[model samples]
Target: MSSFLTNSLKLLSGAIVAVALVTSAPALAAGGHGRKPVDPGFSFEGPFGTFDQGALQRGYKVYREVCSACHSMKLVSFRNLGQKGGPFYDPKYKNPNDNPVVKQIASEFETAEIDPDSGDEVMRKSTPSDRFPSPFKNDEAAKASNGGAIPPDLSVINKARNGHAPYIYSILIGYEPKPVGLEIPDTQHYNAYVAGSLATQWKGDPHHVPAGGVLAMPPPLTDGRVTFDDGTPSTLKQQAKDVTTFLEWAGDPHMVARKQTGFAVILFLILLGGVVYLAYRQTWKGHH
Candidate 1:
């Protein structure tokens, strides 16, 4: 009876150990799951990187040309493009000379007075110092412009939205003409991941539409809208990648630095853990 009771208690202890191991496995796995995949275009290896500089410049051009007509980048300044350590920005940046595009855009705006001591302008050519002014002076005007579709600010948009790179890229590339034969309900949209809640004011058929339902904005980039200067064939995918990367940089210019710092800290901790483990083993030698 004594031996039987002892065997039962041992079996119970083994079962408890097995249960503890099973429960702890998931928690250990959770720590290994790091950041989600960002949009590929933002990556150096992306197709956009073939002409990264030109892509960034062209993206800015696109913003100035078409996107600015609707959306406002209230956070970004023109000077930020000329700042140090940015993909587009060159600290030793030179002004575009005789560039018809730049000239045409610059012609519309007037420069303000420069401060003498600071040598900086009180107002410049919608520079980095200047916040991107909205096309509409007020909310009422903005509503009047786009059938009540208030164009969101582009600044920090990459950060605010989830699924980051891919989401933006998908939004840009996902534009398709309404398909026939498929009857989409008014409530359901063509989202890869549907939203839990939608606004009451949302009109238009959600089906046969982009992922973000009720986007009043039409397919801005159909094929051949913008040509790639690098002799690579211009495609919507390339455009999406370029624009997404440009936006990603704008969203978090310091991501690379931050990632590097984080990696360094992690390495230090790992080394410290190893050293402590070794010391512990040495101290416990011959104890058990």
Candidate 2:
């Protein structure tokens, strides 16, 4: 019995170590122990808060010009952008597929499909219903292009990490020069917002550890890299906020609808409870 107990403990220890190694990489990449992200205090905050269409449009532009190069949003489609509550939503176009803007955006992308007449696979202009295309052909190609790091899909990236938008926002603008004493690899960038322990990489004072983490992805955004059509200044902060907003919308296209429904349900439940109470009192008014 004692021998079995010892073996069980050993197995548990081994499992714990394995799990740590497996999850450590993702944790490090994401902003785990890094500096807290700044709250942008977006317009879409409270239960009744609605998405800002202008910001969404600008963010989409930023994504199209910059992020779309490395990350892919496989879950979202052009039609989603014209949905009732989406960035380019137009009430005139009830069906997002019928939206002219959506059709134009979709046509810009080329996807592989089998031609009905020839039955041969060919690249064709994408339709509103098609999902966003990935930059790399496959995982191996993606890794080869990105220095062996497979960029995470951005479809649900906003929901993947805590403090979603703020976390993403901080990381984008968090690039900074390394401290005078500390040394980092040329390939890696020092972003204070990323989550990683740098004991192995830190050569600074033992008592004063570094404040940020390092990541393979360099500063993805630069001021004036993208020009907003709405005339919003292309500052780093604006770009970060706009892109974060777009990501939030991408991650939860039904967020506004979901919140509105929840509020209505709560109000309906309250009214129902009141009615039940009044009915019970009226039914027993002559008695107790």
- Highest TM-score: which candidate? 2
TM-score of each: 0.62, 0.85
Give candidate 2 regions above 4 Å deviation.
1-32, 116-120, 279-288
Q: Please give, for residues 133-188, the per-residue lDDT of candidate 2 as tens digits.
A: 99998999999998899999999998998768888999999999987677877988
lDDT of 1 by residue, 1-288 (tens): 999999999999999999999999777654322223335545543322322566676666556656778887767655556544354544344543233443444445544667898988685564334455667767788878877667887887777766666766766765444333334454333333222223233355654232233245666665566766566555777766777767776776666666667779999999999999999999999996
Q: Which ten residues in a row have the lowest lDDT in candidate 1?
A: 188-197
Clashing pairs in 2: none
lDDT of 2: 0.89
Error of 1 at 203 (Å): 15
- Per-model CA lDDT versus the true structure: 0.60, 0.89
Query: Model 1 residue 134 lDDT?
Result: 69
